[model samples]
Target: MNPSDAYLAHMDAIVREKVRSIESARAPEQEHYLGQAELWQRVADHVERYRDELSFIVRDLHANPELAFEETRSAEVLATTLERQGFVVKRGAHSLPTALRAEWQSVDFDPRRHRTIAVLAEYDALPGIGHACGHNIIAAAGVGGFLGAAGIGSGKIVFLGTPAEEGHTGKEYMIRAGMLDDIDAAVMVHPFNYDLSAHTWIGRRTLKVVFKGIAAHASMQPYMGRNALDAANLVYQGIGLLRQQMPPSDRIHAVIDEGGHRASIIPERAEMSIYVRSLYVDTLMDLSTRIDDILTGAALMAGVEVERSWDTHPMSLPVRNNTTLADRWAQTQAARGREVLPFGVLPDSQAASTDFGNVSQLVPGIHPTIKVAPPGVALHTKEFADYAATDAAVTAAIDAAVGLGQVIVDTLCDDHLMNKARSEFENAGGPIRATDLR
Candidate 1:
């Protein structure tokens, strides 16, 4: 067999062995609070009764995919669905044209006296691969969670539809607009290859480097012009070399946006976009400084003026998972017959960045993953996108919604758990403005 085929076979064998080991391992017995078990059961029953509706929403979103910041149709459909279900819906929330908000509160509950939780929904699809991220599932599950838990408990539940999570940090914008100021906790689930109680989501920042130079005829007066393309090339190479010295958890990638026109003419201006990611906010800032130095050195060597801009959109912070909340979710998912692995069981290299990280920093939260596709299926691929529409994905969505709803109910009814979550958030240094991280 060829080398590629051999490598694939070897990796598949390893994956199968790992799965067998995981399945054979004993499941941990989690502690549960006796906080209105009847209400929690009602939430689960609500999700079960509304399962077909939730599945239809996911399928509809999958059939019609929209990209970041332009998810008008998705937003409309979600808002309308919530409104029809008797939720007070608000479109264009937080000054975002495509963002949505729906609120519901039990009759005996007062927001001033009790805890409040938010269930976040992200409906934006990737540029070319539509629904590859399984945002459709996220949106439907979020709606189901809000509907299932709204009247079952005493506290207020907010269903937030955040747009543009693919590249733009819509939650960051909403945070700045005071969307999450009154929230106490947040919860959301993402579709993945494996079920996880909690997973690491790293921080990410974007940089745009523009180089300016004089243009002249390449063959005649090469000496009279400084090539901006040369600066871009130097910067790209410097970043590549810097990768060797970077930490294993850090990542840097770049793409040239403007590299000038004709070959006969010396390039006058060039621009390149680069993304830097790290597992911690402090590490991300340190890496940003290194990238800045490299860009400056590249400009100096090419004899060109360089301009650097960071985070044209809001940067994503690393997520902080509240163990108390995660435990509640784990118990709920266990009741549904899914065994969720703890954090360290999966390879940290599989982590990705999300706008929800910004919200998590502001509130105690749990962003769990529900298994939709089989093992070895990575997200944002056409294969994953196709699987997102299958019956398995729809079923996973219903289960995730039930879990999220039950967790919300638990958080609201169990005062001890809510207090523990708040204490954890406070001990973690609480919330900070995203722009102030640097």
Candidate 2:
């Protein structure tokens, strides 16, 4: 058989096998659905049927961008779409008004069983370029994956509408509200620098540091003024000095959000956007304390008062890919002659953060990334935004949706696999309260 023919044949066998397994299961197995093969068929069907709609969703979101925490329309659109798929939708799950959650049953196990799996989607766009990061594509892919699962899911599946992933970390709010209470595992896909999903994320924190001081006429009384800009400047300098002593894997990036109002006056207030990253959340906290010291010390030196606010999401532990789940889908993909590739680099590692990390901490989750654009096509750029609408991205979306659907199905139906996944999840310090937020 030709490659395409072989692939189709492989898919046919997988679906048939999965259906047979589901049909053959005993009474105790009623809690699970049939495995990956059948789910793949249904998911691929959903992706194809909704291709134009998903593409339209992605493009429109890309075309009209909004800033973090300001994704009102997009959140509604996502909630509406999932509602149409028959999910019990709840809007504003996280403290953020724009966040939404879609809940439904798949496995008919215990009514309150923590068999729930969550699929996260981000709809907020960047300030200027809009879906430049291809978040719209990410949202659509998530919808496609869950809807496919909904068709054949034996356990619960949640479609979480996360409002702002670019910076505000809306998941942080939802985490505090206990919205993810019933969820046991969470999964999502992201656009990455490469095709492989590395399954690990570096811990990160965002800080908005502000300085306040007395203002005076610049030319007439510059020296008499307690300049807040001076404090901000010194803080940056302090950061530079600290960087020399930081670990090689550590990262610090900053942008001046506010420096001064007018040249005629010594500025009374200034602010900076800052982020610190390391491989572990503990390291991030430790580094944060050190950075805080620097900022305060700088403000004191400049004779200014300082105020700070943080936008931090609940940490997502490093992605713990359910290898069994990956293997099942990988085999299904390989049956079609497609090799499931590992990340060449840290495909899973992001200098950024996701609430999805919180989900990984609880369940056997995977946030695999696929290659739709060229290797150089960085996310959240006009170039990457352009590619998200291309034919290649669409193809990748369909394939990934099918692949993920298959994994979910296999997870539900295979008792050994499901139990293993749950065990690993618990061992990883699983099922913490949705209200557990730092």
Best by TM-score: 1
Encode model 2's per-residue lDDT on 1-438: one tens digit a residue: 231232243345434534533333211312234344455667667667777666666766666666788888787777778776667778777677888887666446564543667778787777667666778777777777777667565677777888777665566567767756776666677765555433445556677888999899999888889999989889888889888867545678888888888989999999898887754444556677778898889888999999977644444432445444544544444443443454323432344556566556556777766667777777768787778767766666666666665566565556676787678667546654323534
TM-score of 1: 0.91
Indicate the residue-level lDDT of 337 in model 2.
42
Worst 10 residues of 1 by lDDT: 1-10
Q: After superposition, how far is residue 357 of candidate 2 from its true place, in Å?
A: 2.3
Q: What is the C-alpha local distance difference test score of candidate 2? A: 0.66
- Residue 420 shift from truth in candidate 2, angstroms: 3.0
lDDT by residue for model 1 (1-438), tens: 331232243345435545543543445554456646677789989998888789988999999999999999999888888888877788989979999998887788787888889999999998889999999999999999988888876778989999999989989999998889889999999999999888878889999989999999999999999999999999999999988877666789999999889999999999999999977666677788889998899899989999999997789988877766876787788889997886658887887899888888889999999999988999999999999999988888899999999999888888888998889788768886687887
lDDT for each of the candidates?
0.86, 0.66
